[model samples]
Target: MKIAYTVAPGRGDTDLLLFGLSRCLLEKDVRATGVVQINAARDDAGPCDMDVKVLPDGPVIRISQSLGREARGCRLDPTALERAVGLVETRLAASVDCLIVNKFGKHEAEGRGFRTAIAEALSADIPVLVGLNRLNAEAFHKFSGGLATELPPNIEDLACWMTSVTAAKSSTA
Candidate 1:
């Protein structure tokens, strides 16, 4: 299943969640891929250089609008949010089977919220799994219609989950 693993700011560990899900799906032979952040200003390094294809978080229009709002000391206009949402939607179209929106990656410009992107994702025919901190796994499962799975806290948990997915799929098949 194509699952969009998103998180809120200080919500949870996105890196771990993405890595875990990727490993799980791969072990299950589910043809998994990912879209993550790439630091445009820095040399290619870290996960960006990993097997997963990385993309820039914000494009020129969003950046320009954001900068304009900051300079004017005004709140982010709906136009900016719409443009930002459009950027994400466009990337998601031909990008991955699902979107793992890094909602917590950065703060929103005033009047902007991660919901903009989430709403767009919801409109698509993909499953979205939001990661949250403090909330128990059960809550997540409930929110995601039991499609949600707990994120691993360490390498061991990650490996186990991957193995489980693989085994489950194998048995069912």
Candidate 2:
């Protein structure tokens, strides 16, 4: 049950940190699977489009929809998000050493997204790494049942953690 998460202080920093960490782990030949975000800036000064790159050479999916700039509600394309989730879920059964989910967000908070995937990874004895935000902190705590460890936002520390965790998993395997 090696579950870990990080809440970066800067806006969109968590996404960036997780993306880099995931790529680093994969380059190290760690069998990692999950989704990491890639936000594209908009020319109209609107919110950046959110896209997620599935782990282990999986496809990139756009998870955000551009609602009018004034729209206050969620711009998340649930279907697209689920597509990414489905892809990640499909890869979970393979020889995965770790799972790196970019966000434990509203969907997960409502138990409609990566929550089950995270649980499945734990059940399969695979280590899990997730990015979290403050808005969902309470829900994540409740969902994790106080078992998830908080990781530092720095890439070096995160890579170090991933390296150690993957090495341990490899040894045990």
Q: Give lDDT per model, in order.
A: 0.41, 0.90
Candidate 1 per-residue C-alpha lDDT over 1-173 given as tens digits, one digit per residue, 9 for 90 to 100:
42323442432345455555555555554432223322232153211211122233233332222333125443334465455556565665663334444332222222244444544554554333344444343443443455555544454554454455445544665
Tens digits of lDDT, candidate 2, 1-173: 78989989999999889888887887888888999999999999999999999997869899999899898889999999999889889999888888999989999999988999999999888889999999998999999899999988988888888788878878887
Candidate 2 lDDT score at position 140: 94
Cα RMSD for candidates in order: 8.6, 1.0
Off by over 4 Å in 2: none
Least accurate 10 contiguous residues by lDDT in model 2: 19-28
Predicted model with the maximum TM-score: 2
- Clashing residue pairs, candidate 1? none
* Structure candidate 2, residue pairs in collision: none
